[model samples]
Target: MNKQWFVVYCKSREESRAQLHLQNQGIHSFFPKIRKEKIIRGKRSTVEEALFPSYLFIFVDQEYTNFSKIRSTRGINDFVKFGREIARVSEETIKRLENACHSINDLKADTQSLFKSGDKVEIKSGSFKGLSAIFEAQDGLERSMLLLNILNQENKISFCNKEIKKAES
Candidate 1:
């Protein structure tokens, strides 16, 4: 019998743990992971997290490995199923997922940030260098909108992230 892919259900946030247990048992498994970036405490940090939370893929065949031990394995909830019908994933599907994740492993969460409205900021460069402004919002990954009161009217100006820095009060 050809080895078919099956989805393993793991406990909450236990995909890594279950993957390790299966590896020790000589089972072939794939736990797709991705790197995510988050802004915490006004500083940015990157974290490696499971692409499919609490789920991993395992290759199985009736003639090769005994699938019975999977359910009893620590950190494993069970094999994913639909009303007693076990789910089987095709090899092509798994391969596609592997390729997709590999391509984005080095990419960052460009649109995520810790900045919010009303935060004070200072333009570090360009025409408004060293000027203090109110942080309006992040326009995109590389741009932010700041509010500056010019001529007694609020003027919204967009600045690239590289051109601005958090101003200390």
Candidate 2:
């Protein structure tokens, strides 16, 4: 059976526990995380945590048998719902989201925000890593941008449609 990505709604504050329980049940899963800054009692701190709290992704053969077992598990709130049905994410969407979480872990402070105008930039990571440039313009509302790089004695190249942001100086 082909496995599809399904969203799971873990109990409030029990996402990790649910993940563990599902793992023990031989289910493959993933919970994408990000580092968030919080102030608790006048102290600021950064924490590595889930991007979507109480939500986890599971890859499984979607069947009533599997669904029933999942619903019976401790710490499971419910399957993420869309209308009257469980919401399933496309493999591409899940893959990109997973990449964003992982990528952010290695990100520098200056580059945290997605591409912005007038920011010094570079593709320090991903398929286009090591390409350095300056963000002079954006292509659309999705934060994608066009960048200019100087190479080979003042020659300039413009990335027509690129997803890049400010790079750490």
Candidate 3:
């Protein structure tokens, strides 16, 4: 049987733990993660979070691997399935995900901004509360540049991501 990639559903916040258990059992698994900047209590910090929370990928030959053992692995819930058929991911898809993870990891930690240029956003706090703006660029880890229209003039302003949110379409 050819080895194929399959999706595994893991216990909440247990993706890393499940991957470790699978590795210990000689089962190869892939858990993609990305670095992100987050603000907590006015402090900026970098965090590595799972790209697909509570899920991971495993490579195995279904005909030879012990499905029962895999399903019962510590920190693992079960294989993702639709009805009775197990979910399978193509090798190309896995490769693409791997490449994307690598590219993101290679970029500077603060470069992982949530909004892009021309993105519609709303100021949720501060003096600009109840106003809409267009995201211009990320100033730093916590501050972002936005284009706001006020008094019949287009003004560029900076605000924290915490104070801005994507405008509802």
Candidate 4:
């Protein structure tokens, strides 16, 4: 039987624990994580978090691997499924994820803002799509404030990081 990758749904914040238990059972598993800066009790800290919370991948040949044992593994809830069938991940997808994980892990913590104040940016989506604006400041990890000129008045507006991009000079 050919081996394939399958996703397992784990209890909240238990992906690492599940991965460990799977390894102890001699099962191959992949848990992708990323380093991020977060504020803990008002103090800045660097932490590693699962790229996909509550999920991890396992390599198994269904015919040989004990399904019951895997489902009963510590911290694992069950295999992800589509209705009555277990979900399978493609080898190419796993390879891409592994490559991305390596690149993410190799990156050094950058303190510099992605967009400096006064930098020009363009709204990529939402009602303001295609509009150019001036970057004001980062609102949070996933948001930013921009100065949009409308009717000869500059208005401050908030947008998600994905909704804005650096405008070509």
Candidate 5:
């Protein structure tokens, strides 16, 4: 059977439960999780929770007509859809999800904060050295920036993620 990654929709807030059900039925399933800290009752605690709260992935025979059997299970919501058909996620996407499940580091939310408004900064490296670009916003950590081009300056380029450093007084 050619195995393909398919997104399965679990009942609202029941991803883990559905994964367990699939396991009991001898089907392969995966539910990605991440550890995050939250303040509960004014106390900080870490919890390992589903990275995607209502979804999991499964591998099954493409020609299997048993999709309805899975869909009718108690905790299963549905297979993810593309209009009238189930959507197939790429193998690469599924591998990424698997990596997240086995990682020990804290899950990172995409919230890189770089340069801000009204901030005075200098480009520490790259072709724009000595020319100060106004600190704009975080461009993924190592590089943060401001637009060097005024209007007609098409030659100005966006800085690389590793090309920026904050200017000092």
Candidate 6:
């Protein structure tokens, strides 16, 4: 069979360990991570975390590495299985993920742009500086309806465009 990329499941929160194990064994693998700034204990810090937690991709070819060796690898639970079949991922999909990972690392995370409907935005100025709300639409590019939660219920309020910023999430 031709070499194919297949997703492998690892123990909870063990993606990095699993990737290290695969590397020591000389297996080809990819583990995508995203870098973001977070306020940790009142201090700003940058953390690189897995884009896909608890899952890693491995390239397996029957001509070289045996499937059993990969299955018995440390930190790896098993091949992601569907019924009795182990699904193979398309090369194009893997390439796209790799490119995205590269671009994300190269680009800074603080980019901002025009707000759209259903976009979660945080009030950056005015009386509600820290509140997050869902954007509805802009009226004449000045005011827009923001859906906010109060008393466990959604309350739509209109606020000017300059008072809001896109939520980090």
Please give the RMSD to the true structure for each candidate, in Å.
8.9, 11.1, 8.4, 5.5, 9.9, 10.4
- Runs with alpha carbons beyond 4 Å of true place in candidate 1: 108-169
lDDT for model 3 comes to 0.89
Q: How well does each candidate superpose onto the true structure, as a TM-score?
A: 0.63, 0.59, 0.66, 0.64, 0.59, 0.62
Model 3 regions lying over 4 Å from their true place: 109-169
Residue range 40-110, candidate 2, lDDT tens digits:
68754567788898898998987534697897788898888889988888999988998888787756343
Task: Estimate, for each residue in 9-124, the C-alpha lDDT of model 6 and write its tens digit.
Answer: 88888888888889998888998898765767975566898899989999878577777888888888899999989878999999999999989776642223467789898998
Q: Residues 1-169, candidate 1, lDDT per residue (tens digit)?
A: 7788999899998888888999999888999988665666876556778989989899978577666888888899888999998898999999999998998784432323546688888888898898888888776455778998778889999886767777887
Better of 5 and 6 by lDDT: 6
lDDT of 3 by residue, 1-169 (tens): 6999999999999999999999999999999999887876887767899999999999999899999999999999999999999999999999999999999877662424567789898999999899999989877676788999999899999786678888998
lDDT measured at residue 33 in model 2 versus the true structure, 0 to 100: 84
TM-score of 2: 0.59
In order, the Cα lDDT scores of the candidates are 0.81, 0.71, 0.89, 0.88, 0.70, 0.81
What is the lDDT for 80 in model 6? Answer: 90
Worst 10 residues of 5 by lDDT: 105-114
TM-score for candidate 3: 0.66
Residue 13 error, candidate 3, Å: 0.2
Order of quality (TM-score): 3, 4, 1, 6, 2, 5
Stronger candidate by TM-score (1 vs 2): 1
- Per-residue CA lDDT of model 5 for 83-112, tens digit only, reads 998988888988877776666434342225
Top candidate when judged by TM-score against the true structure: 3
Off by over 4 Å in 6: 109-169
lDDT of candidate 6 vs native? 0.81
- Give Cα distance to truth, residue 160, candidate 4, Å: 18
Better of 4 and 6 by lDDT: 4
RMSD (CA, Å), candidate 2 to true, equals: 11.1
lDDT at residue 73 of model 4 (Cα atoms):
98
